[model samples]
Target: MLSVHLLTLIALVTSAKAAISPFTSRPRLQTTFSGLSDVEPFSLRLSPDTAKVCNSTTPGTSGFITADDGQGGNNSIFFWAFESKHDAKTDPVILWMSGGPGASSVGYGNLMELGPCRIASEGGYTVDNEFGWNVNATILFVDQPVGVGYSRGQRIPTGLRDSSLAMLRFLRQFMTAFPELADRDFYIAGESYGGSWVPALASTILRSESRSSGQRGALMVQEDGPNLSPNSRRGPKINLKGIMIGNGLVRRSVQNIGFFETVCSGPASLFNSSQCLEWAPRAMWCEDNLAVCEVDGMKSSACKDAESKCSAISKVVVEDMHLNPYDFRRECHDPDSCYSEMRHIDEYLNRSDVKMALGVPENEPFVGISLDVFKQWEEVGDLWRASDEYVNHLLQSGIRVLIYVGDKDLYCNAAGMRLLVDRGLSWHGQPIIRLRELVPWYLGTKSAGLWKSYEPLTYAEVAGAGHLVPFDKPEEALTLINSWIHGRLPAL
Candidate 1:
């Protein structure tokens, strides 16, 4: 007899798989966008040459659009679209967003991560990645909020927090430019800080469609009733198929505190120990209106010392064990090596294309934008919360929701995602976990595991991946996503 867990897993997978059909049945739709009256519509084409890395053909296209600032300025939003031969119009569209609050989706999000391409060599062109997401659907790589990538803006905006507005403007402009693709099914997807951007953008589309009419307008609504009535005046509801976040930073309060606690304590008891240490201090600080933890002469000194020690240890682990290819145990660990790596990253960013993609001026000083963005990331977070609420409202009104995460990602860990799902949305019952084993997993030859089916929403865990699961395990990620969008769940 099968174990109860395994039985439940099979049932959930079966139900999910039964939901949608394969991509072959769906035809590709020509995409166009509005708001860019000046630019011309163009079709995406495959590069004649195959990539050297994964030895796969990757498709790409370039286009321009008029993006809005919500505050009043309208700028050009240039973009690259990558699609696999298997992709069709009816296939779900995964819109990629890179973190950095100022990162380039094309560089990191595409070449290095999810898209079909990977950097062949240092400062070189890319090759196709076999693990790319395009095998199932169209992957749109955008340089967003203007001023990022080849996209240009009049004045560099500072601390702008309205991702919802930015998305609304971009979509409107994009659709206007690519009117032929108005009917394509779309899903908002991103990583790192994108945890906030994708949700917020999806929410904006949901809100907009709630007031419009037609198939595109009704896309956000659930398949079942409350059907549209003859007398209804509101626009057609926007259908949101699902959302995928890799190494996300969705729960600001939890992630910030958790990171401090998790990496600060000794490795053996780190996770739990950090939480306990934080509990008391956080509770007291909250009760005292944050006054108790405020920086002061003696307290400041202690805090600084603690921060240095934590930083030192974290640097060593993250650099030596994580990013570099050196064996963690055998390599001689050097504290300064971490600093040197940071400097190397700085030098890498100095490349013109990289600087352009990052929206950084050539002469501007390079501080840690990742940390700085965290400090000022609340704006995007607020937008994300609002968007998530809107999406849930759509669900309550009959829309199905799907959320996925990559397991190996430290930034957007599975634990944080679970907490977000549990607290952010109310479900009909307990979430279900369905595990599917992928043959010949990368890094190791063992089979990989994927989780599926969490109530009305489908939550998946992609194995053997980090912040960019698609980049590391593209085939599995694409298969899982394609299956989810089609409503088919894989067998474990």
Candidate 2:
């Protein structure tokens, strides 16, 4: 059973509810960006509660795209698309996803983080987020893996490989619906668990694009198993310009160790050198299990042991040290109600009128994250396995990649991100990565963080931010992405 704390994160992420059962029969449906028609009607407006009280300066729409994941069943992904404030017709396209293996992108990623509007207060109201990502680029927030949020499908996928394949199928359907994006510069971005999803999806897109397009890179990843059917081998390239990941959990072993290292490294250290020595044996065991988990995919006993080992470290930090796993600088106030905004966000989304405006059934319960989906992923040991090989391949293929981490986040902290760049990847740029000096990255007049860049890769650490950097430092996060998408790397 999941701990009370774990279940209570429901508030931070979204409402809590059971996962929707797979449909025995799916509807014959089709949709388009130009016009909303067919099985699902589309609406280009938020609820009255949003418009009446929120400073929603941009226009957006909600719709669903149904696609059959050739592996087993058909999938329908729900999406919220916000047009660019500057010029939607000419701006680049951004594909955003939230990171819980089962988290709602529209729930936490949208309302809580970088969405066009934020939860207003204790009641059901919303306020404008001046730093919303759509300021210059159109953003598509997708609820994925078939069961998170309003998405529905044949079944939840088993591992990173299957989940990614499902997302690839979704993208093909997405491209068919939004033809205007066919030639636009595109970027795939996500955080946390998205660490695996982003790289896996990018690799598939590069490897599976219509071979005639010639944009297909010769990507060979371990996740693209031999069972992949040739007929299921098409993806949307969309002039993929780059990818951005924030505090990603791409390499679990390094991050797991980094968590402990963080508590023992600074002036505010919770464990001194001698105290840290006690965990040396346990750390060794954790690394050994992770190595087995890496090679075994989802079915190894070692992987479950590894998961326990990793969670042990987190438990110590949160329970014993009394520190918040996501933001180590803060004390663990209450796992169930650490942030009051979460509860209000949940209440606002569950409103009948709000659901109606978003084209969702008024009676269907809203869940921010699905425990059932999370359990499915955990059973297969997906979280412990590494997606390093895929990310490394993408880097070597000359795809522009930006990896950023919050300095204060211990969950997927900066130390781990740095190790991922140094030890997890092998590429042409690896030779000079260490030789280059890191420089201060400024948001405007003051330095917000530190960064380093070489054409294909840029890595940075945002100061004074937590696991959700965008939520904690909205202005800085906006400046970071604006600079990145506009080709002004290492400068905000």
Candidate 3:
């Protein structure tokens, strides 16, 4: 349930619904870049009325792309781009992904989180989003992993590596189509399972760039020929600068070790000390088993069996409490409507006029979440894998990384995030340690959060926010991102 204060903030950001603009009169916007010419048929201009809701004159573009790249066959990924309200040439491009390992960035990042427009459910239209992250950069929302949201395909990528490869291919084509974004500073942000997805994708991009530049060595060629090297021919390199993950499941070991500790004794642990103490031995057991599973040359069967035991230890808490694992502050309700406003986004997107305006095929139904994608990964045993090493690679390669979480979130709590960054990962053979103690971060006078940094890596705890930091503390989320992009630490 939304608090009175949050509801007030929502009202301030959303305008009373305006009448819908005529779809027939809206001019078709075409991309002049040759890379995008092939995708011209899928483009649609957002209505003037919707543009007004964003309090900007810039019209947005929404379309579908067959992000095949010959590797993933043909997966149609749905995307929507809101060009900077300011200058496109000067602004950075930020790609946003949502976790579920199967979630839709379109549904979570765009309508429910940081995008510039909010759906006014009562009025059945969109309204301005004052705390929108687009104030400083061009934000791209994608429905990914092949089967999430509007992205449709015969088969979805099962593991993180395959999915990241698919994303890399899609991004190459995306940058080619929108050449202006090719040179702009780029960053990827995501939450939840995104902790794994973002790192995997960043690792893919970084490795691709490194291999293409011949930084490591000669690109390995397969039996076929020189063309056998995947890096032999590559598209334009993306200007990736940094990455941010909120309440992510980046490393299973750290998450598992810290889970019982956080819930039993940390700042807002819901369990009694006795209960937490009882779970302590089990946590260590799970952690130790995972350590063995992570050993080099370990068998997949051994890993799968160990992971099952590890998860069983954690699942006990989730099953026993019946509390929202995402946010301990509340009881678990309808998973879909847990964050009530999310339901409104569904209503807004499902509108026939809204779908037509966005160039979605008239008969294709929109799905906010895809269970098929999730179950497939479970079957393939890809859910409990880790991406900490990949993130470490990015950190060593000089890409800035930010790991943050809502202190109030139970699943990916701030304590766990702090543990992962400080103790779990090593950079250049040394543990990542904070240069300074956690300090207050404010949006004006209000202390909105606490932050600490180790130069290129930073960790933060949003004070009252939950799993969805942006939605719970919009002002602070915006400030945190702005400070990050500008290469400055967030301060008063």
Q: How high is the CA lDDT of each candidate model?
A: 0.49, 0.69, 0.69
Residues 107-187, model 1: lDDT tens digits: 567666666766664434456677677777777787665556545556344333354565565665444333333456777
lDDT by residue for model 3 (1-492), tens = 000001121233231221112222443322211212222112122322334333334445566655344543556678877777666568888899999878778876887788887666564656677788888888888898776877788777767788898888778766644545777899999999989889889989988777665222111111111222133333456889999999998877677677666677756567777777777787777777776656732347777676777665345545666666666677764445566666776666777776666666667767777888788777766676678988899989989898989987777777778878777787963353644678888777788888877767888889888899998888889889888889775664
lDDT of 3: 0.69
Model 1 alpha-carbon drift over 4 Å, by segment: 1-56, 67-72, 87-89, 155-161, 214-239, 254-391, 427-446
Residue 443 CA error for candidate 1 (Å)? 14
Q: 449, model 1: CA deviation in Å?
A: 2.4
- The C-alpha TM-scores of every prediction are 0.62, 0.82, 0.82
lDDT of 2 by residue, 1-492 (tens): 000111221243332221111110112112222111111212111222223323486636555665445655666677777778887777888888788888888777888888888887665878888999988888888888777887777788877788777776666545544545656788999999889888888888778653434332211111111311222222335577788989998888666667666767878876778877887778767755666666775466766667777677668778887877788778875654666777787787788877755656677767777888888877776765688887788888888898999998877988778877766667888867756766899876789998888768888889999988999999889889888888785444
Q: Distance from true position, residue 41, model 3, in Å?
A: 14
Q: What's the residue-level lDDT of 192 in candidate 3?
A: 93
* Number of clashing residue pairs, candidate 3: 0
- Comparing 1 with 3 on TM-score, the higher-scoring candidate is 3
Please give the range of 10 consecutive residues that has the lowest summed lDDT in model 2.
Answer: 1-10
Q: Residue 374's C-alpha lDDT in candidate 2?
A: 84
Alpha carbon lDDT of residue 388, candidate 3? 90
